[model samples]
Target chain A: MTCKEVTRLISESLDRELPFYQRLSLHAHFHLCIFCKRYARQLLFIRETLRSLSQRIEDPVFSLPPLSEEARESMKRRIREQVLPPDQGNLEQ
Target chain B: MNRKQPIDQHQTSHPEVWVDQHGDYLFRYALLRLQNAELAQDLVQDTFLAALRARHSFTGQSSERTWLVGILKHKIIDYLRRSWRECPVDEIDSSLNSIEEFFDKTGHLRDISHGWTADPGTILEQREFQGILERCLAELPFRTATAFSLREMDGLPAEEICKILGISSGNLHVLLYRARTHLRHCLEIHWFVKIRKD
Candidate 1:
């Protein structure tokens, strides 16, 4: 297999299981080509960084800003309007 | 009844309280995936509304935050499905053109020496690394970014992503390939090269 096809396979392998023959070719190419091997390593590293960043995206420690107060108020108001009796929703205002 | 009714029917499932407790986290989650503040806010609100309607079915198998995030995830995917359908075909085709540029006539990669010397631990800890990563993601087209986020960041399976993006599994694979290739190339130039120089 060409290096280009092998590299695309490498990326696809990360997301799904590769067929046995395709896997054989990929490993063969990796054995013969150091560049494709290093490219695989680098792509996996990128995936790892992304996974870590995903965790931090959820964690408040990463410094991602929260929803604005106005957005919060609007959301709450909209939720209240759905759950509350119409007359009651207006009463809170 | 002349008196207004309290919004919270049950203490644990109070929708308004969800807004206070889980609102920002959900917002950031959606914002990172959707890459739109207003749309993220809209999806968060949609999640709360959906949760309020489906509150009766939420059997407390998980924390309220987990339940809310689950709902918000669906909302985001549904939005992506709609928007992706509306995307012009040329946009997707043009994105594919750039992926080909990564290779030369012999089908070997153009940059054989692309180096990523930093260890994963060191890279993850640096605030600057995170900034560069986001910048790279933002450079991708909407479809590719959404596909990558759903697969890598959100950890959705290939089948589910295909369903959400309304594409076949083959198309999904190509989209993900493009995402990984573009992101790696961008970070190599912007982050890894700069670090090596320093």
Candidate 2:
């Protein structure tokens, strides 16, 4: 495959696994082609950053503002009712 | 004393414990995607209620946090999916312009010769780095950001994201590609490049 084809495949590979021979050729191309190597590294950088950021963002105590005291009480009350809350409140754009 | 309950009777503990133990985490998780305090809190409420209803399915295979996060993820997706359908599909974002510029007439990268002086991906672990990442994510177009979050952060299947975003498989690929490339450029310029230069 040409460099252009391999680069596009790199994005597709993120969604699903690449084909076996295609994976082999892409890996082979990485060694022989500087642009493909750089392209692959950039994608990896994005994935790694996202994964780590996702992990930290979800930490039980990662330091984003906690739910307010009143919000907590309101939440507990709603949960205790054991019914889905009304959809009066919509997500802000 | 771990007594296994039937799937229908899978009650583990009172629901209030969930508020104390998980309310904050779930709120932040939702806020990261929704970026709205009210919606985030509301989604956490919905997740807790849903957990109560499906308590029987709490098989104890995962940590409570993990279980709660799973429920929260679904609530966010369902919420976003509904909202996405209500709103018109956004105009194509300018974020793709730089990506187009990266390639030449033929699809080869215009200039991809150099690599990072060091792999800056690890810097994302820092709290400040995470803040920067969130800002970058917030800058993306609504559907672009949602498509990215559903796929990358929530780890939803591409097919699932396609359904939620009301996009085709081909469109989903391009959307995800646009999101990642845009974010990469953002983080590169805002954090990586700034830090490396300094």
- In order, what are the TM-scores of chain A for the candidates? 0.71, 0.56
Q: Evaluate every candidate with DockQ and list the scores.
A: 0.53, 0.32
Worst 10 contiguous positions by lDDT, candidate 2 chain B: B1-10
Writing each residue's lDDT as its tens digit, candidate 2 over B133-168 gives 778887787777788888777778898778767789
DockQ of 1: 0.53
CA deviation > 4 Å runs, candidate 2: A1-6, A19-33, A58-63, A80-93, B1-10, B56-62, B94-98, B103-114, B117-122, B163-166
Interface alpha-carbon RMSD, every candidate:
3.7, 7.8
lDDT of each: 0.82, 0.74
DockQ of 2: 0.32
| Clashing residue pairs in candidate 1 (N, C-alpha, C atoms within 3 angstroms) | none
Q: Number of the top candidate by lDDT? A: 1
> After best superposition, candidate 2 residue A43: deviation in angstroms?
1.1
Q: For candidate 2, lDDT tens digit of each residue in A18-89?
A: 789989989998888887877778877777666665677655435577899998998788776653232112
| Model 2 CA lDDT for position B96 | 46
